[model samples]
Target: MTPTATGIAPTTNSTPTTHAGPAIEITGRLGERYDEILTPDAVAFLTELHHRFSGRRHDRLADRMRRRFEIGNGRDPRFRDDTAAVRANPDWKVAGAGPGLEDRRVEITGPTDPKMTINALNSGARVWLADQEDATSPTWKNVVEGQLSLFDAIRGQLSFTSPEGKEYRVTAERTPTIVMRPRGWHLVEKHIRFIDRTGRGMAASGSLVDFGLYFFHNAQQLIANGSGPYFYIAKLESSEEAKLWDDIFTFSEEYLGIAHGTIRATVLIETLPAAFEMEEILYELRDHCAGLNAGRWDYIFSIIKNYRGRGARFVLPDRSDVTMTVPFMRAYTELLVKTCHKRGAFAIGGMSAFIPNRRDPEVTQRAFEKVAADKKREAGDGFDGTWVAHPDLIPVAQAEFDAVLGENPNQVSRQRDDVEVTPAQLLDVHIGLPITAAGVHGNVSVAIRYIEAWLRGLGAVALDNLMEDAATAEISRSQVWQWIHQDRETEDGTPITVAYIEELIAQVLGEVDRRDGDRFDDAAEVFREVALREEFPTFLTIVAYSRFLVDTE
Candidate 1:
C-alpha cells in the first residue's frame, strides 16, 4: 500500500533529536521560511546521508585525481575490461520506468528562485530540471531559499510576488514533474557544518545536503502525487560514482521506509571519461536508473581539461562552431542513444540553450530555425526526448517529437544494434573550423559577462539570445586555455599567446565597462587566472564560490 503524506512526515525515532542527531550547524542567515524545510528530521536525514556515503564520495574523488594524473602523464583511458561482463550481458535490463517519467519528451532546466520556480512549473515542458548545480549560484540565501521554495512547490503551495507588484503562480493543468539536480561530488556546502569525530567542524557534502533534505520533506508528497524522487546526477566521471549514487538511493529509501526503486536518476554524460563508461554506469544504477543525458558544454570542457597539452589535434575551434553536428559530438550522442536503448533506458538529448529575443525578428527567426534543426536531428536519431532552455522553444522541440512519436510514449524499444563506435571516434577533435579572431574575442566576452552575473548571484543569463550558465563559462575559459596550451593561431594568423589573449580581454573589458559602467576587474581577474593557468582547474566555480560567492560563511 502507498503511504500518505502524513505517513512520510518526520518519524519519532528513539535515536534522540537535537544534540544527538547530526550536530549540524547552520552558519548562513536563515529566513522565517527556512524553518519549514530545515526541520529536525530533514537535518537528521542529511546527517545520516553524510555519515553513510561521504567516505565513498571522497574515495571516488581521489580515484578521479589518480586517473587524471595518469592522463596528464600520458596514459590514455580506455573502456574498463573489468566491467566487460556487465556490459556483455544481453539479458539484463534496467528497472521498469518509474512514475512521472514515462515520457520525458521535453524538459526545461533552470534555478529554483522564487520567480524562476513559478515560471519553470508553468513551463509546458514535460519535466522541469530544478537545478542547483549549474543553473544556480550557491549563495546561502539562494541555497536555503531555493529549498524552501521547492518544499512549497512539491505541496502545490508555491506563489510569488515581484517587487514591481507582479504575481505568479502555478496554473498548469498538468505541471511538469520536478527532477532536482544537486551539486557534483566535488562541492561542499560550507554553510551547513557538522562536528566530526576529532571535534572539527566540517562542511557537509553539498550532494547530501540538497538531496537528503528534499527527499526527507517531499518524498512522500511526491509519491502521493503519483511521482517519485527523481534526480539528474551531474558531472559524474565513472561507473563507480554511479554505484555510489545507487547505494545512496537504496539507503535513503530504506531509511525513510519508502519503497525501493522509487528514486530514479538520469546520469548526465557530461565528462569525457563518463562517455566511455555509459554502459557500465547504467549497469551500476540499473535498479534506480532512468536514462542518460548529453551534457554538451561540460563534455567539451572535459575534453579540453583531460587532454590539455595533447597538441593541435585536440584543440577545438569556437564554441559556436563545435555544434552537435561536429564529428566528436556526433559520435558521443550516437553512442549514448545506442547504449541506453540497448539497455532499455531512455536516451535524452542535450539542451538547446537558445532563448528567443522578442525585440528582433531576424534574431528570433534564426534561433527558431537552429533549434528546429537540432530537435529534428535528435528526433530522427531516435532520442526519446530533448531539452530546451525557454518555454518559447517548447513547441519547436515538441513538434519534432510529436511528428515522430505520434501516440507512442518513447522509443526505448528501438535498440540501435547496427550502430558501432570506437574510442578514437569519441575522442576525434581533429575536425572543426580553425580558430578565428571572432572566436577568441567571443570566449573572452562571454566568460567575463557570465562570471560577473554569477558573482552577483545569478547563474542563468541571456546574452544575445542564448541562455548562458556555469557550463558556458567553464567551456569558454577552458577553450581559451586549450588554444593557449597549443600555441594555436587564429584565422587572422595571430598566435594565441597569453599576451594576445590578455589584449583581447582588455578590449572586451573596456567595452563592457563603457556600456555598463560597472567595473569588471573581479571578473577579468577570474577569467585570466583560469584561462592563463599552466594547469586547468577542474571547475572554475569551485574557486569563485569559495573566494567571492559566499554571503554569510
Candidate 2:
C-alpha cells in the first residue's frame, strides 16, 4: 500500500477485517501512538456516523445557502411561522445542566494542545471548553495529537515540558469540567475519506470525525469519573441542525451503551438566523440541551455576512465601536437570556477576548477592568456564566459572577419575562458611529496576520493584547468586504475601495514582522480574494483551508 500525497494509500477494499463498517481510509500520517486514538473500532464508529448522517448534513447546508440567497434578495429572516408552536409553548423546558456542567461561571476556551489542556484544566474556570473548532487549525498532526492530549488528560496523565526546560501539568486540586466543542457541520476532514458503495470516496464530515472520535475514545471513561460526554455545539443556523445533533447524540449514547440523556449540549447562537430560532433550537434538543451561549464574535460576523448586500443600512460600524451595549447586540443577549431562562436553561454570556500582557502592567490592568465590567453586566442581566479567552481572566470573570451567584450554581431561576424583542430590534444595525481609518487598517492588519498564523498551523493568536481566532478573523475580513461593497468611507472622507485596501495591505505587510517561514505573502493573497472580491466568500477559513491546509499532491 503505497501512500499518496495525503500520506495514506488509496484502496478499493470494501470491507476491512478489523471492523464491520464502511470502507474507510486514513489519508493522513499517523503520529506516534496515534493508532491508539484511531483504533479500528473508533474508525468504524466514525464510518457508521458518516453513513447515517452525512446526507442530512449536506441537505441542511443547502438549506443554509437557500436561506442566505433569500436574505440577499431582500427576504429578511423573521421568527419562523412553522415553529411558532415550539416558541409559544411556555410549559416545556430543556433537560438543563448535567453533572459536571451545572456551574459554568467561567469557561476558558483554547486549542486542545497538550500544554493548553493542562493549563485550562488547572485554570480556576468551572468549565474548560476543549476547542477543536475555531481555535484549532485541523492539521493532521493537530487533530491526532489533540485527541491524544485529551486522552491523557482524561486519565490524569497529561503533561508537557517546554524547550526551555520548564514543566507543565494539571496540578489544581479541583479542575474545571471538560466540554468538547467539535467543528461545525460545514467543514470536512480531508485527511480521512469515506468510500461509498460505488467506489467513490469523499472527505469525512469534520463534525462527526471530531465528535465521534472523542466520544468513542472517552465517553465511558468520563462516565466512570462521574462526568458525561458534554459538548458545546457551534455555528448552528436552524432547529433542524439542532435536531441532527440531538439525533447523533442519541445514537451515540445507544451505541456506546451509555444511559440515555447522558449527553448534554449547549448551542452557540452565533448565526443571524439562529438568533431568530433560539427557542426552536432549544426545543428540538430539549432532552439533551443544556443552554444557549452568546457566541458574540461570530454573531457580529454573521450579521455582517447575512446583510452584506442590503445596502448602507445593514452596514456595520468599526468593529471596535460595536460593543455589547449596541441595540442589536443588547436585544440578542436579552432575548437569549429571556428565552433560555423561560425554558429552564442556563444563559451563558460571550467571550472576553482580552489576553493580559504580562510585561505591561497598565495594559493588563485596563484589560482586567474591561473584562470585569463586561462580566458584571452579564451577571447582572441574569446570565448563569460567561467565557474568557485566557486563564488569567478567569478570576476576573468568576469574581463578577461570584458577586451575583454567591451560593447558587446558576441563575436559571431568574426569568427575564420583561424582555420582549421584536424582529425589527434584532435586525436594527444602526450603530451611528463613524468608521475610522484606523479601523480599516486594523482590519487589514489583523486579517493578514491571523491568516498567516493559521496558515502556519496556529488558529488562535494574540495580537494587540487580544486573542484573535477564526471568528474574529471572519469579522475583520467580512467588515472589509462589506465596507467596500457598501461604498463606505472612513471618518476623514477617504473612500474604501479595493485599490485603497490593496495599498493598506501593502503598508501592513511592511509594518508586520516576518518570521523565517511566515506565510504573509499567501495570507495577503487570501485576504485580497476574500475581502476585495465582488462576490463575497462565505467563509475565509474554508477558502484558506482547502487551499493551504490540505496536503494535496
Candidate 3:
C-alpha cells in the first residue's frame, strides 16, 4: 500500500494529545501499532524539537546552497585557517567508542524491514546499521514500520515468515549493536505537520522525525540493555552542521533524563566541503562523537555534483574506474583514519557493495576475492572496521580486521602520523581511465533498474551481483549528468549529447524486464528529468518523491 497524507484529523479518545505546546497533526493513516509509536508524549517531543531546531536546519540547508553556488563560480573549498587550533591541538580527543561499539570490525548495513532486521542482527557482525536514509524509501509505511521493526528488534521480538512457510528469526545469542542512521537534514516528512507559534504549518523535519521517534521510544530501553542510542550522521557539509547535531544530542539526553554524552555519532565525511573540515567536525562532536566513516559512494557523487561545471579536469571517469586505490579516494580514506585516530575515535571504512551470486560459483568466488582485497587494504591502512552489504561477507571483512587487530578491540592507538593530504590531492579526479560506451550503458541500466525498485518501495536491490542503494543510484545519475554537461566523449571519441543519451536510455529500457507491476517507465521519466535536464537537480530522490511518492488522499 502506498502511504499518503491528507489534512489533519481531529483527536479522539484513542489518539494521543499534546496538552501544552505547538500543535502537531498526523495526516497519514494510523496503521496497527502506529499509535504506540506516535503516542502523546512522542508527538510532544517531536513538536518540541521542531519548535527549537527546525529554523536552524533551514539555515544550514541555505548555507549548503550558497556554498554550492560559490563552488560553481570557481571558489574552491579549502581547510579553514580559523579552525587550525582544532586541528593542531593534540590533547583533545573524542569520547571514543561507547559500550557495544568498542569493536566494530565488521558492520553490516541494510534497511529496517522485519526480514532484513532479522538477517542483519543474526549476520554475526559487530554492528548493524539499521539504515533509514539511503537504504529506505521513506514511504509513510516504511517510516513508521522501520521504527516498529527496530523497536521489536531491540526487545528481542522481531521475526518474519515468508509466504512459502519459511521462518526467519534472530537465533544468535549475541546480536550486533544497533546504530541507526537517520535521514539527512535536506529531506522532510510530509505525512506529519508541525504548527508553530504563528499557526504556520510545515512538513516535519525527516531527520528529527526519524531520530526523535527512535530516541523517544527506545533510548531508555537501549540504555537498560547496555547499548546507548548510537547514530551514523549522513551527508553533513560542514562542522557547523556537526555542532548542530552535537547540540541536538545534548538536548535529547537532557530531555530523556539520560546522561549527558550518552549518545554517540559517527559523521559520514561524504561531501566535498566536509572532507576539508574533518578535524573541526570531530572537534564539534567530540563530546558525543564515536568516529568518521569514508562514505565513498556519496563522496564520489559530491565531487561530481559540486564540480560538474568546472570542465574536464574535475569531471571523473566511469564509476567503476574510481576505485579506493585512486589517488583522490586514497587521500580521503587515509585522511579519515588519521583525523579519527588523532582524536581517539574509531575509523570505519566504506561499504563493499558486493553480493554473492549463488547460482554461479565462479562469480561468487571473484566477488569474494575482490571484497577480501578491498577489506585488506582498509585494514592495513589503519581503519578499525569496514562495512559490508551481505551476511556472507562478515567473516571475509572480519578476517582481515582480525589479522590486523588480534586480541584488541581496535587499532586506534596505531595513529598514522606520516599521513598528510592536501586540498589538491582531495580534489584530484584526473587519474582514472577514460570513459567508455560500456560505462554509459551500465550507468543508465543501473539507475533505471534501481529507481524502479525504489519506486516499488524497495530501497536496496541487487543488480548484476552488487547491492545498489540510494548512494550508488546518486553517483550513477550524477555521473551521467556530468558527462552530458561536460560534453564528454567515450574513449572511441563518440560525442555524448542529449539525443545520444535518450537513445541509450531507450536501449537500456528495452533490456529491462517489463514485469506486470514494474515502474520502469516512470523510472525512465525520472532519469530524463534529473539527468537530461538543463539545470541539475540537487537530488533525484527528492524530485521523484515529490512527484510520484507523495500521494495526498
Question: Runs in model 3 with CA error above 4 Å?
Answer: 1-21
Instruction: Give per-residue lDDT, candidate 3, residue 285.
Output: 96
The residue-by-residue lDDT of candidate 3 on 256-354, one tens digit each, is 999999999999999999999999999999999999999999999999889999988988888898899998899999999999999999999998777
Clashes of 2: 0
Q: Candidate 1, residues 79-190: lDDT per residue as tens digits?
A: 8889889888999888746888888999898999989999988988999999999999888778888988899998889999999999999998889999999999998887
TM-score of each: 0.94, 0.96, 0.96
How far in Å is the alpha carbon of 33 misplaced in model 3? 1.2
Deviation (Å) of 261 in candidate 1? 0.5
Weakest lDDT window of 10 consecutive positions for candidate 2:
1-10
Segments of candidate 1 deviating more than 4 angstroms? 1-22, 513-519
**Cα TM-score of candidate 2:** 0.96
- lDDT against true structure, model 3: 0.90
Distance from true location, Cα of 102 in model 3, Å: 0.6
Each model's Cα RMSD: 4.7, 3.2, 3.7
Tens-place lDDT digits, model 2, residues 56-122: 9999999999999999999999999988988888789999998888888999999999988998998
Model 2 regions more than 4 Å off: 1-21
lDDT of each: 0.85, 0.90, 0.90
